[model samples]
Target: MHSILPLLGATSLAGASVLQQALINPTNQVLFGSYDSKPLVSSEALEAQITEKNLRKRAEDLFSIAQEGVEEYNHPTRLTLCHTGHLATINYIYATIAELDDYYEISNQTFDAVVGNVFEYRLVLGDRQPDSVLAMSLTPPTPDKEAVFGPLVLVANDGCNESDFPATIKGAIALIKRGVCGFGDKSALAGKAGAIAAVVYNNENGSVSGTLGTPSKYHVASFGISNEDAQPLIKKLEAGDVIPSSAYMDAIVQKTGTTNIMAQTKGGDQENCVMLGGHSDSVAEGPGINDDGTGSLTLLEVATHLADYKVNNCVRFAWWAGEEEGLLGSDYYVSQLSKEENLKIRLFMDYDMMASPNYAYQVYNATDAANPVGSEELRNLYTNYYEAHGQNWTYIPFDGRSDYDAFIKNGIPGGGIATGAEGVKSENEVAMFGGKAGEWYDHCYHQLCDDLDNLAYDAWVMNTKLVAHSVATYAVSFKGFPKRTDVKMNDVSEPSIYHGPKLIM
Candidate 1:
């Protein structure tokens, strides 16, 4: 039998055959292969090899590493790594989020309630808020204008048509129920009816503010109220009560900032690197635990464990900022890189939300028409992993909706997996994933309720394992994949910009 001294560092016959069997197995080939002279290494030799540590072990260790990251912020209860210069998420870039742009006060924004007039009113400012609140008296515009408001007129139904406005609505505020038509249409219709201002109460339970599509002469300052507050007023109005309320709005916009965290291995081959990351910031409402805490921590843990092993390629980890502000951080980083620098990256994998309470195993559908080449293999990596382990999985379209958007846009191959977000669970998904049907995969999405309790540990661990698997797999080899230098950057479109409220960090 082959000597066990070199493999195990001590000759012990008890496990020699098992070690010998492992050595002969080609599948167990280690990365460095310093101990692989005789075709394959023994189990003892392979165990001694860096590759034998396994992805699951590394993934499990992420819990503590993530905890360390969270604790670094001095928040023992929850980790909100927003707007910090934390190294855990920092990469090659050293600037903060606001520094990404120099013109027009890039990240500055400020808004406070308009003093006495601010009686819990939710105003819809479509993508533009004034730098300072300029109080304007509420009044109905003239006939040549869109709407009139003075004697408030209650629309007969959801304000979709001109007929909903009666003759009595002239020079009066139009009180309309929300339904049937878009908010802009209702506001414009009310404006046409000679209403001074449009008050659209939500059909649902929350306050609403939205766009009016495009600017029109008829457009008036529109507002929204929650159903709870509107119901009592609706009753009084039907009983012939005239409710007169006036409020002033003062909006302040300032240029402020946050940051993205990036960390890369100093040991691996810098010429060929693999990158992965998720957003580091959270919405202002609450600490985003499952949204990306899972993703960020996964990378940190992988990076931590990887420190002990040697690899053929470099691994860079990033925690993006302003992702909720429209993937601005990642976009800026990629834009700053030269064509030569961009080509240094072989691939990027984005991990956003990976632990929805009602989780569904979702692999990116790289086969979709929009995908760049080599995405199919990335998708196959995730799908194949889940399937091999007898786990159910599904596909989410590669719609340029995450941090991966910038990487793919510049022609780097990319793929990833997410448990899910605000998407509602289907009855079929309920059957497959064993969670409540008709509920959101993340019920607390973007809300203050998204705390540590929001995570499903089983799902979190599973997805992190997959992340480790991807990292280890790619770190070991890239034989079948195209090199970054060989592929020209595609003229890809930017990810669909979300003009809605910022819901991520």
Candidate 2:
């Protein structure tokens, strides 16, 4: 095992910085300066110390964080970091000796919240005997309790202009094809006309589903249908068939509170911070133990352990909220940063769902052409580590599927690790990882069953050690990463836009 005792007395630290000097000097030592001359200094030793028992204890500590909310709210709701949810997680983080604790918000956000939609629709074709048909899909925030019944009018692609909705659209249900602009814009334009509800069929095949970007003044009850299902109606409308349909929406739109817990080290180079995070909130379905609790606690445990170790670069740890609601907290955090602060973040690492019971070691495909510079190196870090341990690994795209979405949107180099979420295991994955094939990575994903028992301790310990490895490596040096001086200043001027495929739990 690698030992750290000899490094403490090395004379090479004579000219080092404050933290380096403290770490290297034997006389001016703090907690870890000299621990019985047999400290667990090496990465392997540290990893060894993070036993399953320790993880259970730390997880229990995290449960206490949620327990506080349960006591007050009479039920644990670590659902989102918004409102009281944010306060509880923040309190827990502050209980640690973090240097920075703050909530971040996007400048000039119009709605306090564009709450997620909860609506249902029933389709009825217009004829002497109209038949009841079901919509293949429905978008949220549909007009709750209100129903819109009328003949369907087709609006072609890029349904943003009023002209797209023909004069017949007045008091009718607008049938718009999805393309060009967002689903919200099409619905808004239809609402601008006299259309009571808007239904956007998919531009391609299969079921249609997407957010309206956000709530709008002109937004009406909106839902989606498959191209195949909508073609008959489109053809009938083309043949002048007055197909009448009824659309209704029931949704709750209100401002809910949440917070992002950002903790920066006070003793490191503030100009070149190494940032890492995982979403702090859970889905409303369950406690979200493996979904993100494992990911969040990985960083939290690492942060607590590093309290005594000095670092060259400021390491910022964030426990984001509203991730399940969309990448809300991370997007807001990126939005509020100044240009200088944005540039200071040399790299961002995201961790979510680190312990899927039926797991596959998947690293983000940072080597993809779309990723910012230095991403490939991040990929290599994890790949090399796993390979060194004789473990097989796979790659997932660096798409905007997680909290890393916001960072990458602004051209910040980002990478992360995940044990799968709803994805089913393949035979190859089964052979490599020894998990059952054709089963979800996490059987209880986003379900009420995602409790403490859902975790796979073996996977959790291994993945969390990887988190520690990355933190320790970057804390000591940015060897495999681009330095602050070499960073390309990408314009992150675009205001925060949280739009994309839903990040399934």
For lDDT, the strongest prediction is 2
Please list the C-alpha lDDT of all candidates, in the order they appear: 0.57, 0.66
Can you write out model 1's per-residue Cα lDDT over 265-329, one digit (the tens) per residue?
A: 54557788778878765543445666666776566445544433556666777777655545656
Q: Residue 245: error of model 1 in Å?
A: 8.7
Candidate 2 lDDT by residue in tens digits, 1-505: 0111111111121111211221211233444432223232335534544557656765665555554445434554566523343345545554443221211111112113333525345555454322322232124444447665787888865586777888888888888887767777887899889888887776676666566665678877776777877788789989887786777666545556555666676556777777899987776546677778898878866775665456666788888777776777788888777777888888899999888889899999876366667777888999999999889999986667789888876778889999988778999999999989999999988765677778888888888888878877776677757654423444233332224235110
Residue 277, candidate 1: Cα error in Å is 0.7
Which ranges in model 1 have alpha carbons more than 4 Å from their true place? 1-120, 123-252, 486-488, 494-505
